[model samples]
Target chain A: MTERISFRSAQKKALDIARTRLLVGGALLAAAFLVIGVRLVDVTLFSENGPSRQANARNIAVEKKMDRADIVDRNGILLATGLKTASLYGDPSIIIDPKVAARALVGVLPELSEADVLQKLSSKGEFVWLKRHITPRQKYEVNRLGIPGFEFDEEERRVYPLGRLAVHAIGFTGDDNKGLAGIENSFNTALSERSERVTLSIDVRVQQILRRELAAQIKKFKALGGSGVILDVHTGEVLSLVSLPDFDPHTIKQASRSEKLKEEFKNQQFNRTTLGVYELGSVFKIFNHAIALETGVANMASNYDARKPIRSHGFTISDFHAENRWLTVPEIFMHSSNIGSAKMALDIGVAAQRKFLTDLGLMRRSSIELSEQQQAIFPAPWTELSAMTIAYGHGIAVTPLHAAAAVAAVINGGILYPTTLIRRDELPANGKRVISAQTSADMRKLLRLVVENGTGRNAEAPGYLVGGKTGTAEKPTAGGYKRKALISSFIGAFPMNAPRYVVMAQLDEPKGIKESYGYATGGWTAAPVVSQVISQAAPLLGIAPVDETAPNARRASAIKVATPRARGQGIATN
Target chain B: MKRPATLIIFGLAVFAGAMLFGVAFEVSNLEDRLTGLNKEITRDRDAIHVLRAEWSYLNQPERLDGLSQRHLELRPLEGRQFSDIAALPMRPNRVPTPTTDPVSAETAPAIAALVNAEPGGLPSAETPIATALTAKPKLKPAAPRRPARNVRLASQRISPEATTSTAASDKAALDAALRAIFGNTASNREGASR
Candidate 1:
């Protein structure tokens, strides 16, 4: 095929060859792209392969979604966490021989019976969990069995490593990883939906202190139960809140329902400080003085005719330690005078008294970190007599926390807060206002007087200007107030000139101790407990123990009283 | 004929070079993914380490005991041990102590060669050692309750393990030494529970 070539013809032939080469290259590129398109379609539509997530296409399920956050203390201590645990789950329907698989599984899991395993494996269901919350070791043992149908389902298990220490605040979760109680249940959304830890106000060290003290008191007094709490005056932050009869949140089985947990709650079972509400006794006198002082019904020099009890509705209101003489405002508080308090409330008028209580957050249920809370019981119909009775902490039943909040507002510059459970930043949450600042000052004076000369005298702690009122409310049963059943409690603040902290200690049905001079009233038993608590806590809380001889301390000790005629008229009317 | 051969070799060499470069790029991309995975593991490990440290901090028994002792003068209640606050009579009013600060009067004991002879001569004002000891109790009323007990539990006998200054030094040293020898355990994670 060699043809003799002329110069012009040879050049034209070369150009034609170049054009053919370009056509070939374009055809090859189109064919290659077509092949790739066909393959992509085969994998997307026709393939029987596996899950859609391309990275894990060989696996049965999509990349197992694992999204959970942790709960830690402000100090970075892990309180609650969702840890990824290897759980033993299986494809039941895919098992080739149920009996063989069961035998193999039983060998690995000693707890499982061969018969039981076979029944579960042979079941018509496509999915079954062999064991939940399996350990890494167990997963390894089971995997070695080489059961084709068995597989692992990535699962999240909630763990509270601190157990019962901070259970009420950290809370526990259910199998489906839902919040059940405490912060776990209350702010489940923030804990689960968000990735940040929920830091509670509870200090682990302070909690330990409160728990240990309560436990000791319960044992010493032969009390069936006990509870304790510590609150910051300015912020209303709860440093420590303990309820005896606690349940370990780690193992759900140990903490059955409240019915079971109640039995376990014995000495340390129920959290009496916040959750349990009682008809607290003389402690209510603080509320009455606050109301009186706020309404301008009395001054520090005013006197109340506390010589006789005020009898009404066949019920007598009198001091536990009767002071059968005229008592100045400070004297009435120092003596925990129920009779004097009645007169003071009467002077303030029934409407004003009710308004004061409403302002103190007593008329509602507590809004704390834990969901478990009870509303304080108050008289259904607000009456003049009810006003007088409630003033002395009768005709109304509130939680120890209710007593704590009212006392806190009375001394913390009259700003009332919904006692908190979670630890917050230096700046406190905005709180609701319930009383005036001047009244708070007067209440502080009255509280200090009580510690120095009243029923709370036993509660005085050297150096820490201690002040508070003691409550020993007799439990009202079918046959009037029972002599045996008593709600014994004390609420106190230190450095009363400018208060810092509030500590409330209560012993449920505390029995008389020999050293207590055979008296189980709030003054003898619970007040002394506070003294010990103050002595130990003041230094750690960073309060400088000032000498009582100081003029500032002496000047602040005055307590205002609602004069005598107000008391005489109140008594005669009742 | 020789020129045509040269042209064919040139074409072959260029095609081979391009293929080799493409393969190398693919290998390097795969390696990059692996390195990214290792970095993620390290981040997770660091997070775990921090959480573990926090857990230990919260559970430290000495801290809890100190707080408890201060608030209630209450000891940790074992099942067998329980004492009431009311069991003790109004803590008998303490008799006034006559002393200056006790620390200077009874100088600290030499432990671990921490103390040395004072360079300055002694007395400015004469204060009795007994008075100084008395003053000491008032300064740290809570310390006497169980200072010894805390010392025992903290380090099984506190050696002043590592405070602010030492802790930083120790951590840095350990981190540097480990990083030098191990290349990054996260990068070559060849074991479980490692």
Candidate 2:
């Protein structure tokens, strides 16, 4: 009986131990499941950022991307684009036979030297470049050779499809696709970072016309070189900018390889329209006449004695075609009388002349986007002699672009808008007002008078009513001006009543042709080019031609001038 | 009862596992399609990039200028060629008595019918149209109607013999008229301007 009781107690003790273990295991499992459930809820509904969001963020990285943005003209014609190309590279360590591989490569790419390729392939280095960019057909031909070490590194090459058309504007890229010059250098960061295209203010058709006409004139006159710019007078957008003797952007790569091409490349890279500064002679009279009218020192009826040349400080200021008599303001501008302009400048004083030119944005470096720009060379002390010479555009020198911008300000109601190469949706409201609207109108009348009966008669586009000034500056040398080498330039605006465009053409050292009556002056050379350009570009720009025979058309460009001969004799030459 | 409940739970677990595997496979298949589509898009984009570059090369102004000079009779427009719609002279009230030229002889009956079929039978002297036409004594016979009629007839019928001969004649006449009006075949334009 005692044994049976002991056995029952042992069975109960064993059951009790098993039950305690079961409870401990159940508690542990419940805690683990609760932790997992809480974590799931936090991740799905409560966590601010999660792995799922990170995965989605990664998906966005797979969208289309460009190495560099395209450069287009105002009409969306592609000026510069990035084309996909494969660069040939090799793993020299893996190349079984360097000579055989190099020979095969030279067979496909005739441009590559076999010895050079072999040397590169035989190097101990793990990687070497066989070539930078290869044609697709060459890539295929190389692949067919089944060379072990050969591999293609994908890259994009910058190409200008229009060749040398606008090389000075669009610029070119280097081997690594970095912009080297022109707008490429100016807007490098923006181009590489953004996928959107850069739209320039240039009209390719207008550019073509300007280039063709400038080139033809340069060839005909046997000039050294030429540059031209056509700007929207009101908006300050450059429609066309052409610098002659320009090189194709594609040749830049080859230029580095050959010494002859290097010399040619350096010569062609000089952008004359923006970089080279010259004492643009009579063109400055546009500013002088404008200044005289605006300061109220001279009017259309105002007269100065131009009977004899003014000899001041060992310098004689005389007219190119002297009308040796008392001259009114209109007569001085029309005949380009340097003596009359000097006397007028003397009356206005030096301070006013400097202030007026500064106000016209001609005293400083241009605010254009090009990195190739020059500061205007002006007299530092600005003496009386300087004022007189500057009045006829001698003491001060500026670029053709500066002259263009200043002329635009003069004809565009005396407001100077900052010039730009990028297209603008609206005229900038921050334009500085240099002269009164009345003064601007008076200047237009003077410009028209010059084109009508004076030296700029060659600038007439007939019904288009072109009005401009002729500037024939003797190229300045180290000690004095060279008489034979002249910068013959014409700065003109068409439809004089409401001028829309400012066209400036300049020929460097143009020799006289028989057709020009042995005259290489602005009136003989540059004026005809301007007239042709205006006539051809007017219809393209949607400018309607007015019948000059119509009474209203006659009234639009007409200015009344008092006869200088009737005014009287000389007021005594200084 | 416990046995049957355990059996039901086991069966439900098997169904849920199968559903999980099926959904995972479907997701994988969709991901594969997405990858393929992305690849195709990239290839097509590259092709478009190449084609755009080629197009720009082909459309160079210098090349186009050369091509036009060789293949086309068109020339740059002159200022005198443009005039306001109001400046154009009014249409002539009376058509020129059709010439008995071979092409015109074939269409003379059609033109007579067209002129006679006018709603106002005689076109009186006092009518505004007649007055407008009479204002310009140098107005030429505007023969625009005949070519338009020929185009309409050429499209509507398919008879091989008679229609083919007339169509050929009509085409030649149309070409001459078009060359005179719009095509800058200089000779034709010079005659018309004179």
User: lDDT: which candidate is best?
Assistant: 2
Model 1 lDDT, residue A332, Cα: 76
- Model 1 compared with the native: what TM-score? 0.71
Model 2: per-residue Cα lDDT at residue A131: 89
Top TM-score hit? 2
Using DockQ as the measure, the top candidate is: 2
How accurate locally is residue A530 in candidate 1, as Cα lDDT from 0 to 100?
74
Q: Tell me the tens digit of each residue's lDDT in model 1 across A1-574.
A: 3455565579788878887887788789888989999987887688865334533542222222235577766556677776677778778878999999988888888887788788889888888888888888989988898879999987788876677776766767888889877778888887777755677777766666667666777788877676677888777778777777577775665445578565664434345776787877878888888877777888777887887889988888877788677877777777778888888888888889888888888878776777778888887788878888887787788877777877887898888777787666765657766777777887888888888877888888876789988988787888678888777888888879889888888878888889786677877767777777777666656565553554556766854444355544443333
DockQ scores for all predicted structures: 0.06, 0.16
Error of 1 at A34 (Å): 21
lDDT per model vs. reference:
0.69, 0.81
Q: Indicate the DockQ of the complex predicted as candidate 1.
A: 0.06
